[model samples]
Target: MAYPDNLLSRGESVVLSKRPHWKMLVLPIIFFIVIVGGGFTLAAVLRNWEYHTIAWIVIGVLGLLLLIWLVVVPFLRWRTEHFVITNYHVFFRSGILHRREHQIPLGHIQNMETSVSFWGRLLGFGTLIVESAADQPLEFENVASLPKVQSVLNQLIMDDKQAHRGGPQQGGYPTGPTPAQG
Candidate 1:
C-alpha cells in the first residue's frame, strides 16, 4: 500500500513490512497441546462422579483459556505487529487492544544490528536492534527474512545520508546491493 505522501519527504518509498513468521507459533502450539492434555488427564482421574464432572468443566474452561492465551494470542500479535521499512524511516507497530507505534527516522538511526541464534538461523528468522539518537532503542524481534530487512535498512540509511549531501528532489531513493549481495 502507498504510504501517505506527506509522510515521505519527496522520494521515499516503502521497501517491505516484515511480520513474524508462522513458524514462530510452534512454542505456543506445543503449550496449547500440553495444557489441553493435562486438563483432560486431570478431569479423567477424579474418583467422585460429581467431582469428576465439576473437574471436567473447570479443566475444560481452563484449557480453553490456555488455548486462547497461547495459540490465539500470539497469532493475533503476529498478525498485528508490523515492522515497516521505508526509504526514510523504520516503523514498529504492535497492538491488540491499545495500539502503539514507534518510528525511527533513518537520519536518527545511529546503528543497526541483527542477531540469529542456532534455531533462528535454521528457521531463517532473527531479531533486529535499531539504535537511534533517542534514548530508547527499537527492537524488531522474531522477524522473518532477516537479511532482506537488514539490507533494506542499510540502503535506506545510506540513501538518506546521500540525499542530505546531494540536495533533495522528488524521485524514488536509490537502490544498492544488500548485505547478502556483498
Candidate 2:
C-alpha cells in the first residue's frame, strides 16, 4: 500500500516512499516451503488410502497454522512497513498486530549512512542508517534504491543547515540582563 497521505504534517512534502526490499522476503519464502514440504512428507508417510485421507486433513490444518504463524504474519508485517523521507522529517512505520510510528525531524538529524554487503550491492539494495540528535539511530534494513536515498538525505541535510544559518540564532548570552562591564 502507498504511504498514508494523512500522516504527513501540513506543508510537508514527501521525497521518498518505500517498502523494505524483496530481499527481506527470502526467509519468509523459505519458511513457507518448509511448512509445505513437511506437510507433504507427513502425508506421504501414511501410505494406506484410509490413513492417507486423515493424514492429509490433519496435515492441511497444521500446515495452515504454521503458514499463518511463520510466513503470513511476517509477510504482512513487511507489507505494512513503510519508510518515508519527507522534507520535514524521516518516518518509519510498521506493525502487523500493533501500530508503531517514529519520526525524526530533518533539523535534528546528525548523520546518515549507507551500507551494502557484496550480495546486497549485487542485488541493488542496501541498508540506510540515520542518526539524529534527539533520538536513537534508525537502521532501515534491505532498502532498495539505497544510493538515491543517500543522495536525497545528503541534500536534505544541506538544506536544513542552510535554513538554520539563514534564521536568527536562537540562543546565546542572556538578553534580559547584562553583567556590569566594569
Candidate 3:
C-alpha cells in the first residue's frame, strides 16, 4: 500500500514503503482455514441430529468469533502496520483504531543491522534494527528484502549527513551555501 503523501514534509520523497512480510500472516491464514473447515464439518455432522439447526447456529457463531480473534485481528494489524523510508527519515506506523507513528531522521540514525535466521534467509526476510542518536534501537520485524533495505538506509543516512555539512550530495548539489562561501 502507498504511504500517504500528506504525512510528508515539503520536498520530502518516499524511498521505500512496505508492510511486514507475508510470513506474518501464515498463522492467521491457517487459523482462518481451520475455522472455516471445522465449522463446515461440524455443521455437516450435525445435519441429521434433532437439534441440528441449533448446533449449526452455535458452530457458526463460535467459528465467527474464533476467525475474528485469530485471523481478522492479525490481518488488520499486519495491514495497518507500515515501514516507510523517506529521504529525510524512517517511519513506522501501526495500530488499527488509534494510530501510533514513530519517525527517526536519517541524520540522527547512528547504526543499523540486519538479523536473519536460517529460515529468514531462505525466505528472503529478516529483521532490521535501527539505532538513532541517544535512542533505543527500534526493531522492524519480518522486513522483506532486508539487506536491500539496510543498504538503502545506509546510503540515505550518508547522504543526509553530507548535505547537512554542505558537502557533495546525492544530486550533486550541496544543501545550501556554506558559510565560507557567504
Candidate 3 deviant stretches above 4 angstroms: 169-182
Native-to-model Cα distance after best TM-score fit, residue 130 in candidate 2, in Å: 1.4
lDDT tens readout by residue for model 2, 41-129 = 88888866777887788889989998998899889988999989998888999997799998999988888888899988898899888
Compare the candidates by TM-score and give the number of the best one.
Answer: 3
Instruction: TM-score for candidate 3, please give it.
Output: 0.90
lDDT of 3 by residue, 19-87 (tens): 999999999999998999999998998899999989999999999999999999999999999999999
Per-prediction backbone clash count: 0, 0, 0
Among these predictions, the greatest lDDT belongs to: 3
Name the better of 1 and 3 by lDDT: 3
> Mind giving the per-residue lDDT tens digits that candidate 1 earns over 1-182?
33344655677677887778668778888997899788877876774676677778888888899889888888888778877888777888888999898888899999888889898899899999989998577777888989988888788888788778764333454456668897
TM-score of 1: 0.74
Winner on TM-score (1 vs 3):
3
lDDT of 1 at 74: 88
Worst 10 residues of 3 by lDDT: 166-175
Q: Which scores better on lDDT, 1 or 2? A: 2
